[model samples]
Target: MEKTQILPRATEILPVMTAVMDAVDEESGKGQRDEATGPLFSENEPAAEYVTIGCSLKGGYRLTGVIAENTGESSIFIATNGQTERVAKVYHRYKKPKEEIIERIKSIRSPYVIPILEEGEIAGRFFEILPYYKNSDLLKATPLDAAFVAQVVVPQVNAALKAIHQAGIIHRDIKPNNLFFSDDRNSVIVGDFGISSILDDRQSVRLTTASRTLGYSAPETAQGFVSTESDYYSFGVSLLHLITGHDPFLGMTDQQILKVTLTDKLHIPSTVDNTIAQLIRGLTVKEREDRWGYDEVERWCEGQPVPVKENANRVKNIRPYVFNGEEIMELDKLALALAGKWDEAMKHFARGYISEHLLQIGQDLASTAADYEEETNREFGFFKLLYLLNPKAPLCWRGEFFTDLVRLGERVRECLPEINRDYADLLESGALLHFLRTKQLDPAVVDAFARLKERCRTDRNEAYYKMAFLLTGSNLMKWRGQLFDSVDALVGYLHANREGDIDAMAEELVGSKYFYAWLEHLGYGSILKQWRALPYGR
Candidate 1:
């Protein structure tokens, strides 16, 4: 091994070229030869204006002048064209053909992978060229700063693996050094497909004569089981590295790293969130059967919600006082009525007539209209305000209010779209009636449910599905038996656009313990069974 140095002009050339030239010069018995015979640049070429940095690694190569050096093991450099930058990885000569690995990597078409440029010998040393990236590895950064690692990197990496596996290629080496970040810092590119194995036409595997980095290699690889799943295990290990900020076998010696990987003693970081930690452990399991396939891993990543910080102590207390006067009065009236002080609440409601408080109350209420709870209110006080204002207000406002509340509940059944009722005001007033009667479901609730169903159909928004399920589940519980007809109608409305994880929805309903009876009444037993059978065991 030779000591690494940063040369002034070395940044101009490919990283692997620099490393190979430096290694040969350091290791060769003949030290600095005349400039004419030196490996870098043509003998007659003038020492270019670019600076060259060099370094030596524990392995066979000495790296001379980094093409691009930031915080990771790989080097990036500009291609001869000067437009696109390429990465250069110079590994020890291996028995497996390099061209085969190059071809396999080139076949993958994911944005997460760095495409190979060209591969050949330069100055008697073999090197591979990859597209140069401008982002730092999550390995060297804190997990807190790399929240995108879990949200973006892991998902994209898993998706890339699925594509690679589909192409029948196994990346025997999957680790932090192989993962690169794109210029924007929002995307990642997996590089260095060295040690990758391409399966033959028959699905049964053939062992490739190659060695992987000690800490990141899978156990079965040691036993010669070189399939796509082995790469999955490596991906799992890479994820662990990102989360824990240390290798799984970090403190262990080389022999120990190899030994513990063969045994079950290797432990994942328990301090990690349980969902992610479990994913890590499952991926690194010695038994191939226990390991998740790339698609399954992708699904798991999809299912995981962003991890919420647990300790509220660090959170800054910054509540904004956002209530308007009308909203405050409405809330006070509701609170008073709920507290059995209906007479005082009614008095406050009537105060608008004498004190000309309607305008102020209306403004205040309008201010609080955005509050989720206030938007749900549907009582007589709300209607009374609307009725008083309808004759003088803008037609759009009055019409919207009317249309939103009609047929809101059984109590306002008379206000529904009958022969002569104003349709807009009827809907609004009905919704308001429903809100007043239930106090749980807001007037906006039904619209939200309708929008959720549309989004599920058109956009497959999972959040919408979850929200709609929650709202319907709550309403079903409140209306149970008494509002069976209405609940059934609402269920039909919700069920029409149901998509994704029905079992999970059932589990959520069951977990709440509020909608179980309603769900049963809705003939959901078989639905629940099928839901439970889905991948998430919903």
Candidate 2:
């Protein structure tokens, strides 16, 4: 929570991380025609079934090298001889485990737990032969039905968690990839204890808060707080994902994910059984102490009624400060309105429109900005700090507007000769911004855009208001030997028809013939495309 530790806002959004290994190609255990015992390994390598059968685990079953990677550290191969089938997980060069914990896992008895058949340390690394259920894993069974999750998945996984916890261990990572179906019924069993830890396993590998595939991780863990309750939170999330097809935090940055998990109320589909919904609610509350422990899960699985109450440990919502002047609160909506893409957001401003706060903030920030000899990221920090200070502040604008202001201002200071061309987009982008800021258009701005003839394009809603104004309602102006006739007749035509039919609007528009299915003309489509870089949640 330290200010120095804070980075850009979550709405800045996080870039996507490197993609995970393609499990699809390797799921069939056929090696996907890859070289098994070579001095090299590739990303496209597939899973093989009958290889690596020669590895003896402390001198026991003959393991096949079905998946022999000459360049990687891990390998998987199935061992079967007419009756028994088991998966041999070979970790080469870099795997560590406490023999005491592995022994405890073997001693714990549970049908929903993947039994460790045998394990051994050949070199510095170790390998374990686990009971392999050839049926399927949860990763393969996406979008499971709600009934299946409540009756089959949740109970079985709860049983597994009970057994693991009883053995004083915690499955730090609980996700689809770590769950497999039992060979007997449609029941699921917990597997992959590779990253798991025993209660006293202090020498264990440090499980980072931001580890890859964190959607199922608890919010506290994402912020570097870890506990058994964190595991319960993750299990709850995994269950939700099974019932619903995707992670709730999908496509979000780490920061954004934290914000959502911490503040937003999670949506449990109404179609799900109310009991199941209540169970999930109990498990996923933000506070660790509020989450359901294995004891509660056991009681539910046993058909005993458990009372659901408001968690005393759950954090209370703190509403953002309300500013007396309403204008500041609605500046974000106004920005969008001014951009001409105002229809969708208008409902939010809710007709109680105000702008005194924005006009004041704009004036103050503009004055402060003038004091800077050179434009820098700090110029924008003022706005961001204002947003943080006033929790009630409307998003105020997509992050793009402030950056565009600085960029355009720099162009003015550069004092480059205006290129003689018609509808040159780059110069026009800046010129249009200047007009929006101060209604009077500068001569240099107009001359810089004097045409050799091409359409200027930008979709930034902030930039569009004036351009939209010129397109929709104004008559053509022959200024300095250039024509502004395209779509310029829109407003007059609308008044003549008295109907604001967008389809009709599209037809009357001129710069380009293309139109969107939304019925908006594409004359300004190219202009909007330029704003795609801005991290607006939508």
Give candidate 2 regions above 4 Å deviation: 1-60, 65-73, 81-83, 122-124, 200-212, 302-538
Please provide, for model 2 over 130-216, each residue's C-alpha lDDT reduced to its tens digit, 9 standing for 90 to 100. 877777688677788877887898888888888887777877778886899888758888887765656654522223212324556
How do the predictions measure up, each by TM-score?
A: 0.42, 0.47
For every model shown, the clashing-pair count is 48, 23
Which candidate has the top score in lDDT? 2
Worst 10-residue lDDT window for candidate 2 reads 12-21
- In order, candidate lDDTs are 0.47, 0.49
What residue runs in model 1 are displaced by over 4 Å at the alpha carbon? 1-80, 90-97, 142-146, 304-538
Residue 83 error for model 1, in Å?
4.4
